[model samples]
Target: MITFAVLFIAAFCAGVQNALAGGGSFLTFPALMLTGLDARAANITSTVALFPGQITTGFAGRKNISDLPQLSFKALFIISLIGGVLGAILLLITPVSVFEFLVPWLVLFATLVFLWGSFFRKIHENPKPLGPLKAIMAQFAISIYGGYFGGGIGILMLAALTIAGLDVRTAGATKNVLGGVMNASAVLIFLFSSDVAWTQVMVASIASIAGGQVGAYALKRVNEKRLRICIIILGFGLAIGLFLKAHGS
Candidate 1:
């Protein structure tokens, strides 16, 4: 009961974070690890558990979604699906020890990426949009990463989309949709994996869905800058804790 309660709270917060800025895995992944799963198993379970909430959040912001001039949304969607499948395959084949060793570094890298995207990246007054080839390439790489680990894919996509000429609002909405699309492919693969913690997945998924609704509703009303700062701090703190844990072990 305590485990379920903890997972529910963590997943709920993750859902809200994901809807607002896109680093929910930072929460769910660690929470699962604390529940006694190994790093790879935790990651797989986190991806599967959070997927439904992602869809809900994306759908709630569908109105702001738009296609890039360089690439159609359909084209990007297909790329995400293919790349996600490939990444998932790679993850499944990765040894547990290797993944555990990589987890801390991955979290750190993702935190830095999110920090840069959230605060440091400057939008030019007359930004040049990425060409079709460049946009496609970027999206494919991000999709693969999203499938494999998905720490900061949301901000990564937002940066890519904004560079491709969408406004912040549009990029955010599109990012939400594409994030779900890529993860949908991963979830399909993870559903069959022996690593998934279905009991935790069930509890987390329900809590996350409820939290997504709250987050979607708060998207406009909440102070995003403040929320993003909180996420950044949490991310960095988690990264440090994970590194220490890894070193001690």
Candidate 2:
């Protein structure tokens, strides 16, 4: 009963944070890991459970989402799909010890990229000739990282989208959609091969959707910049902690 209550609160926070800034895993994953769960299991569980929050956020923002300039969902899906498949395969084949060592560096890099991401948005406001391709490449590359470690992926995706000439809100939306793809793929793979706590997923998913609907709707009335900044700080601070923990363990 306590775990259910805790997960419900966490999912609500995650849904709101994800809708505004795209880094809800900063809350969910660590919370799961703290429960004596193994990292792989926790990663899969967090992604699967929080996925509905993202979907709800996406759907709630349909007015804004549908109005965004021509994005090739087909093309985006292809890159995300291929990347997710390869990432899952790589996860199965790779050694945990090796990935364990690399996790700190990955988190640290994502933090720095997000910190200095203003340059990418301001200077590269418009994509050069092959901008869309670059965006796809960025998403493809990050999908592997998301699959492998599942931390700070929102920061990575937002940074990549900035580099590809997207404003923050658009980048946030695109990041959410891509995340849904990577997570859905990863979840399917995990379901087929591993034991998943479906009860947990159900609990978290319902909580997340309710929270996400509220959060996405609030975007219409709230101060977005302040909210986004709060999310970024939470994300970066958590990333730093994850980095330290990665090396500590």
Candidate 3:
């Protein structure tokens, strides 16, 4: 009962954070680890658990999504699909010790990228546009990362899309949709893995879906900037905590 309650609350906030600015894994992943799963298993379970909420968010934002100026939506979608499959395969073969060692650093890198993008957005109201080739490359790389770990993937996508000359709304909607696509592929691959905790996945999935709806509705009333900052703080905190855990063990 206690574990379920904790997971429910964490997943709920994760859904809200994912809807608002994309660091929900800071909550869900760690929450899974604390539930006694090892790092690799936790990561896989988190991906499966949050998938339904991601689908919901993507469907809800479909109307506002658009292709980048240089790349068609179909091309971008294909890149994400292929990248996701490759990443998931790589993850499945990775050793548990190796994954545990890498988790903190990956989270730290993602946090820094999220922080840098936030700063970049604030400093340059009209940043120079990214070239099509550069944007496509970035998307492919980030999609692979999304499939492998998927902590702050939305931040990565939003940054790439914004650099590609998209406005905030369009970039956000595009991120949500492409995120769902990447995860959909990854989930299919992860389904065959033995590491997933189906019970936690089911609990988090249902809770996150409900929370996503609430977060979508709360978008009208919430201060997005504040919510983003809170998630960033949570990301940093989780990264630090995981670093200690990894080193201590």
Which candidate leads in lDDT?
1
* Regions of model 2 farther than 4 Å from truth: 34-36, 66-73, 119-130, 219-224
C-alpha RMSD between model 1 and the true structure: 3.1
lDDT of 1 by residue, 1-249 (tens): 776778899999988877766778878877888788988899899999999999999999888788998789999989999988877887898754554466567666656765776677785645467899999999998898788888766656766776687765667678888889999999999888999999889989998988887877777565657755765676676667667766864
lDDT of 1 at 92: 90
Candidates 2 and 3 compared by TM-score, better number: 3
TM-score of each: 0.83, 0.82, 0.84
How far is 3's C-alpha from truth in model 3 (Å)? 1.2
Local error of candidate 2 at residue 101 (angstroms): 3.7
Q: How would the candidate models be sorted by TM-score, starting from the highest?
A: 3, 1, 2
lDDT of 2: 0.68
lDDT per residue for candidate 3 within 1-249, as digits (tens), equals 787789889999888777755767768987888788987899999999998998898777777789888788888899999889887887887654655577677667766765666555576466567888998899898888788887767766765776687765666667877888899999999999899999899999998888776766654455656655654686677678768867874
lDDT of 2 by residue, 108-214 (tens): 67656656665334654543523665666777888877766566677777666655656666666667777777776776777665645677778778888888888
Worst 10 residues of 1 by lDDT: 95-104
lDDT of each prediction vs. the true structure?
A: 0.80, 0.68, 0.78
Each model's backbone clash number = 0, 0, 0
lDDT head-to-head 1 vs 3, winner: 1
Report the candidate with higher TM-score, 1 versus 2.
1
| Candidate structures ordered by lDDT, highest first | 1, 3, 2
